[model samples]
Target: MSETIYERLGGEDAIAAVVDRFYERLLEDDRVAHFFEDVDMRRQRAHQTQFLSSVAGGPVEYSGEDMQSAHDHLDITPSDFDVIATHLAETLVEFEVEEADRAAVMEAVAGYEDDVVTVAAD
Candidate 1:
């Protein structure tokens, strides 16, 4: 069988780097930066790394709250989800991940859109 995205992306270390850059870009963007104003980024980043590693089929297990429960009170809109997804895609590209691998990763994240997005689109 082919390698998993986690293996292809260089496992936990690379995933950690990607998560850091993804959150950095998200925090810098005007559209989504406000959502993180009160968040504990260090913990968030750690959770995100575990989550992404899990998604990518790594050995890491995500011990954080479920997506729906995590975002239940965040009031996240579809646009917010899109922006975050875009940042993720860009960060993957920045790390020179292959297109197919990036698409697979994005698809994995998109699977949780309904759970993460609490608000309807306009």
Candidate 2:
């Protein structure tokens, strides 16, 4: 795979397609439904595409808020992040994304756990 994350992820259209399936699975997966029940999927999808695109070494720039600040109030547990990651991997496999690229995507997100998930108050 090329060093560019965009080429690894099949570029904008492919990333968009993967994000679509990922959200579809999330909606149907009861375990993750609560996290997204109040979310506006359309906007979320756009944000995810931009986020992933930028994270994956693409040309697109993502100027969104810091991950920790964005997710700090969600009280997202590690397990929740695991479920999301697993489903995302499945979505990528379903779309026939290359294994190397899949690994790259996973590796990229794996490093962001501290920023993406925070323990909710008791």
Best by TM-score: 1
Clashing residue pairs, backbone N/CA/C < 3 A, model 1 = none
Badly placed stretches (over 4 Å) of model 1 are none
Error of 2 at 69 (Å): 1.2
lDDT per residue (tens digit) for residues 6-81 in model 1: 9999999899999999998988899989989999999999999999999999988999999999999988999999
Which sections of candidate 2 miss by over 4 Å? Answer: 1-3, 120-122
Q: Write the per-residue lDDT of candidate 2 for residues 1-122, one digit (tens) a residue.
A: 54686876788888999899999998899988888878888999998999889878888998878888888878888898999999988998998878987898889889898798797432
**Model 2 Cα shift for residue 118 (angstroms):** 0.7
What RMSD does each model have against the real structure?
A: 0.9, 2.2
Count of clashes in candidate 2: 0
Best by lDDT: 1
Query: Which residue pairs of candidate 2 clash?
Result: none
Worst 10 residues of 1 by lDDT: 26-35
